[model samples]
Target chain A: MDEEWIKTTDKKIINLIRLTRKNTLDYINKDINVSTKTTRKDLVTNVDKSNEQFLVNNIREIDPKSKILGEEGFGDNVNSMSGHVWIIDPIDGTMNFVKEKNHFAIMLALYIDGKGILGYILDVMQNKLYHGIFGKVYENDKEIFSPKNISLNNGLMGMSAPLLINDYDNMQSIAHKSSGVRIYGSAGIQFISVIKGELIGYISHLKPWDIAAGKVMCDSLGITVTTIDGNALDMVSSETVLIATKIAHKEILDLVK
Target chain B: MDEEWIKTTDKKIINLIRLTRKNTLDYINKDINVSTKTTRKDLVTNVDKSNEQFLVNNIREIDPKSKILGEEGFGDNVNSMSGHVWIIDPIDGTMNFVKEKNHFAIMLALYIDGKGILGYILDVMQNKLYHGIFGKVYENDKEIFSPKNISLNNGLMGMSAPLLINDYDNMQSIAHKSSGVRIYGSAGIQFISVIKGELIGYISHLKPWDIAAGKVMCDSLGITVTTIDGNALDMVSSETVLIATKIAHKEILDLVK
Candidate 1:
């Protein structure tokens, strides 16, 4: 994809996201019709599927030859980030959507031949959108600078309940050494907190759709996003993801390692 | 205070809270000048003191002879909840206010002759107020019905990081048995979640101002508010507080025991 063409596509995709906001809000305000996936903890709702279909259809209309990897399987079975691929998680925090009715997001990203071109994460209820183009991050229309570099002992950390209980990779110690721990039950919400400089870092076992959009946003802001160990992220597979400031990143990896 | 007098007082207090919203918002949006209280984790800002003074001055004008218990130490030190006492936590979750700027709240409660007459928790950013009058709970003037009676394993629980890390009273086991765990870092926010039926229970070590208003609201909705060991809460002292749906309360007590 050409650079100029990618800019045009970004505007179109953002408008599409804004257009779908009302329908998603309606579904969230009303009773959510839900069904379980692999486990009872894993939930899928009508809104999740409908939102995915809505995005996938519009993307297909805009770029007929583009490949899309969607959470609800409405798009292609993308094995790799080939030319002109869009990755989306229509509703990243489906459990929060079903139960709390807040703290969830609509995440979408665009890649051109294995390189991220654009990323967007829209917090549905708050109406706040985090977008990144190439290597610039923006909240709404204003570009966001890098958050202050704080260490693990001076800032809060977000963790998964499963990891905390099982003490996976010495997570308990990582949590103990941080200023405090917060668990909002949504990976997207946690990611936004880090982007806004509220949380020092976030660690959880996440699928590709869960971290794809967030990863781009973090990378643009000079934040570190990698596995529990200091390693590069495999964008096509589920991995133990850790996102943090530079100082906290090294401290957490040392403890968890 | 008589019943009619209490009603009038509630109206006046609500108006005062509404009037103070602008000043609080100004402080939060602008630079918040913060100071350390006992430790760095325990924070007190200029806004906290100003909000406390605002409430105390208004309450004194209304009832000059009344006693007040305040977090900022601007009010009277009443050893007993003798008559016409007010408890105010100018800003519950100050850490959240200073850090997140969205999850903190203004909490106030009125007790007449050692009986809870009114309680209010205002989520400043969201403009949602949770109040109760003598066993009747309301969310911004709309009456709230009782939350469903769900047991521990069937519902989500909100807990604190200290409790989880120390495994206080076997908290880790309780968290493991529940559907999942959530930590919002604000006791008032967690209380509102329970009142709104989003969380089954919330447990934390809280001061009197932290839980006084929330206790009144939860009791009105038939939710259990008590010590972790199932003992009655001491109204004038700090203690470990647990707010939960009735069934979950009993189950958690059994497990902790």
Candidate 2:
């Protein structure tokens, strides 16, 4: 997606994501079909399937030339990021959606030749839509200023709960060194916090759909999103990723290493 | 206060809290004066003082006969929860209010002769008001049903950061036994999660205003709010409190002990 094309599709992509949220909310009002995938912690709901299908079908119609990768396997068998590729997490934080019925999100992102172009995340419960077009990010209709580049000691952090609890890679020390730690139980919600500058950073192992939208948005601001050992993120892997402000990012990378 | 009088004050108290939130939002738009109270974490902002003053004055006029204990020193210095007493935490999570401008709450509760009567907690940014009258809890006028009594292994738990990080009182084992762990950085927000059955329990040290509203609400919902040792909560002291569903409550008490 070129700059002009990215700008042009913002309204359409946003509208489609908004409609997706409406449909997801409607499904929650009725009984849901939930199943355990790889593990009990790894769950997929009927809502996730239908939402992914809806997004994939619409994206294929809107951009006939693009390839798509979706969490629920509703899209193409994507291998590489060539030409135009869209990533979809029909419902990020499905656990929260199933357990809490709140704090869940709808996420979508567009990439061109492995570079992020446009990304959208809607915190459906809060009714807040956050999106990035190239280098400018907006909360709803208001463009957000980049958060200050603060160090770990000066800011809060969000960490994977199990990792933080079990002291994985010195995560316990990381949590204590920061001003505070938060675990909202949603990758999308935690990404929103980092993008909005509420949390200086978050560390989690994320699949492609989970990392794509945030990576695109963070690239616009001066934030860092990389593998735990500070490598470029693979476009199609479930890798341990660290998303943080520039300064805190460096501090954490060195500490964990 | 009689049950009838308590019923009459519902609309008035709710309206006052709503107005206080309006004022609090307005203040956030302008510059704020922040001062360290006891510790950096235990901060008190200009908004805290003013909101407490506003609530204290209004309660005096509305009830006139009740004694008030407020977080910001705007009300009486009472040692006991005797007779009609009202407690106020004008801004619960002041750090969050000052730093994130979200996830904070405005809290007020009424106690008659050392028994909980009415309690109100407003999640300001979410614009969600949850209250309890006598033994019935309401989340914005809609009555809430009792959450299932679940054990530690069957549900998520919220642990205080320092305790969990340092493994205080075997917090690490407790966190591991539960399905998951969360740390949201706000007492009021965590309390809401437990009352709504989102979490099976949460443990933290809380002051009077911090515990009052949640305690009253939990009393109505069969949730447990007590000292870590399972003793009755002391409303005046900053006690280490554990609030949970009944079964999870006992399970945590045993694990921590």
Candidate 3:
């Protein structure tokens, strides 16, 4: 696709995603009853299902041919990403949303033929969006330069629950080498750290929706996002994703391997 | 001490701590020249040292006989809690403060003859304060009941860098049994989680100032604050401190031992 066409489509999608996110935040913020959908562990609070359904319905209307993969099970069982694919995490940090009532985000990513085209990470409380299209990344429309490459020994890192304990793929070694480790229980916030260069990397075992948008945003900023073993991630599958600066990436990969 | 006397002293000390914290925050927020005081591994930013001095000066003016032990070496080299000993962590999460400008806290605890008389943990950005005197806990002047006693299997746990990596005293086994583990790099914030019932407990290798205030606050709320081996803590020494609810305390001790 041409640059101009990409820009136009990107602008439209960015505005749409922002609107959808704001609506979702507003809906949840309003007084409402909450209930468990399937099991106590699996919650489907009014906001969760509503947000996913809203995104799916709007995406279907806007691009009838695209396949949607959504966390709330509102979309199809997308087995392949052969054509246009839109991955949505309506509420990426449900526990944080339900408990802390904050630190959650709405993540959306668009991919065409396995290449990330656009990404959006909406930080609800701060009302700042870390977004990107093609080669450019932005924080509320202001262009942000990629942070200087920092090594594990000099910067903090973010690791998820299971990874921090099990030493899954030698994560224990990586955690020890980094200056510190932070776990905020939100993929969107973790991605924001990578973009802000506050953290050297974030490693988590995540679903497609949890990382799709973040992957696109990181890729645009010259950051590396890959599997724990330094392999390209299959966007449609759950994997141990490591998003980091170039130097941190090398150190983590070495330590983990 | 009588209950009424404890309550009154708690209120007075809490107010004083809040005022001192606000003054320190304002001073640091202003642009000032800073130089490294120690190895890059152990930074003593201008704000850290100056904040301690500010607290020391104010404490001496208010209570000339009180002994203050502060993080930045501006206060007395406290070896005993013989009188009205005040333990202060001018900036609990200095790295976070210097880097992200958030997540750090000013912690103060007043012990009268080796007994905790008052404690304050201030969340600067949110402007919320968790404080306690005797057996009553308060969040910003409102009474706060002890959070539901959650078990290790049902709640999150917090671990510091060394504990999480080296599995100090078999922390790995205890962490594996919990729902998840979170590391936020701030002693005050981690203590806030326990007091708020967000985490089952937090374990960290810390100094007297780093944990003195948290120890008092947690103990007042009926939470266990002790060394990992279930020994009483020496207020003047650095050790692996474990703060948790009753059930989590029992479970973690069993697992780690």
Candidate 4:
């Protein structure tokens, strides 16, 4: 892929995703009826489905041959990551958006021939975006240098709810060694923390869209992004994902596995 | 004790505490000298010790004969609440202040003749203070009504790190029943959430200063503040404290105990 073309498309997609987030926020904040998608486990408000549809429509217009893997079923059911692929999570932290009205984000990533080309994470409340073009990562407009590589004991770590409780692969022991564990219920926020070096690492069982953008951003920053067992991440599948600095990643894998 | 007198002293104490928080934020944000007070577990940076000393001096100047219970040991060792007593946590979330440079708070509570007269929790980052005077509760300058009674299954809950892992008295079961759990490593932020009706409740093994202001604010809002076993809180002792609305409180206590 041409680097200049990737940069241009990345900027366009980033703006589109930001617009989608703004629309989603406005829609949810408006007086709209809310219905449960499933008892309590899943929720499909109008904003969520509508935002996904909006992203799909824009991406289809821009890249007619690309495949989209979205949280909502509006996008095609992608089983492989060949050619150009766009992975999106319209409203990443749905629970926080619905309940607390804060701490949610918009995530989008582009992959060409199974290689991550662009990544973007928009933190809605903070109004900041962590984005990467090709191999260069930026927070908002300025380039963000890689954070200091601190061990788990010296930094905070973000853990998902399920991993914390069930000790998913001995996460409890790993959490004990860290300064502390913070669970924000949003993969995007967790990923941002990992990139900012505020958190040594973030671990969770995530879908493709949840980890797609994060994986590219973390990898570009010289941080390690992989499964809990130190296996390479399969971009097309849902699996346990870990994003961390090199030292923290090794420490966590050793402690957990 | 006259109610009018209690009200006057409460307002004065809240003002003093707010000023102390401003001083702490100033000191922490800039370069400051620090020394280890005791073991690494118990830290006494210049900001921590100086903030407490400032609070104690102000309390002495305002109420010469009042008893004071403070975290930094600058005040007299208060054994009983015979007269006016002020419980102060100069820097409530020290680890967060030292590590993250945010998410910490200053907590202050006034008890007149063993009764809570005033409570204040300053969320430094958001710049909002959850305060209580007599029967009214305010977040910053605006009065906030108590949140609707929400069940454990419908709301989020906050818990301390240790309790979550050790399953201290079966807290895991209680957490499992709630919609989700959040651990922010700051008693002040956790308490603010409870006051704002964000979290159904917050649980932790807390010192008197850690729980004092939050307890008074929750009490004023018709929320229940007690030990995990449903015992009234002892203002001078550290215990497993649980603060929640009526229904969520009962449900969690039932599951935990």
Query: Each candidate's DockQ score against the native complex?
Result: 0.61, 0.64, 0.39, 0.54
How would you encode candidate 1's per-residue C-alpha lDDT over A34-62 as one tens digit per residue? 99999888889999999999999999999
Q: Could you give candidate 3's per-residue lDDT for residues B91-143 as a string of tens digits?
A: 78877766556677888888888988778888776677888776788889798
Total clashes in model 4, counting residue pairs 3 or more apart in sequence or in different chains: 0
Candidate 1, after superposition: displacement of residue B236 in Å? 1.3
TM-score of chain B of each: 0.97, 0.97, 0.91, 0.93
lDDT of 2 by residue, A34-138 (tens): 898996667799999999999999998889999999999989999999889999999898878877788888999988899998888899988999898859899
Cα-based lDDT for every prediction: 0.88, 0.88, 0.80, 0.83
Ten contiguous residues with the weakest lDDT in model 1 chain B: B95-104
**Interface RMSD values for all candidates:** 1.5, 1.4, 2.4, 1.5
Q: Which residue ranges in model 2 land beyond 4 Å of their true spot?
A: A1-8
Compare the candidates by DockQ and give the number of the best one.
Answer: 2
Q: For the second chain of model 2, what is the TM-score against the true structure's chain B?
A: 0.97
Q: After superposition, how far is residue A191 of candidate 3 from its true place, in Å?
A: 1.3
Which residue pairs come into collision in candidate 4? none
Which stretches in model 4 have alpha-carbon errors above 4 Å? A29-39, A134-136, B1-22, B29-44
TM-scores for all candidates: the values are: 0.94, 0.94, 0.85, 0.92
Tens digit of per-residue lDDT, candidate 3, span A1-257:
56786677677777776777777667765764456655443445677778788888888876688899999889889888888899998877776666556678888888888888888888876778888886788999899888879888878889886677777888877877777788988889899988887787899988899898888878878899999889999888888888999988988888877
Error of 3 at B34 (Å): 8.3
Judge candidate 3 against the unseen true structure and give its global Cα lDDT, from 0 to 1: 0.80
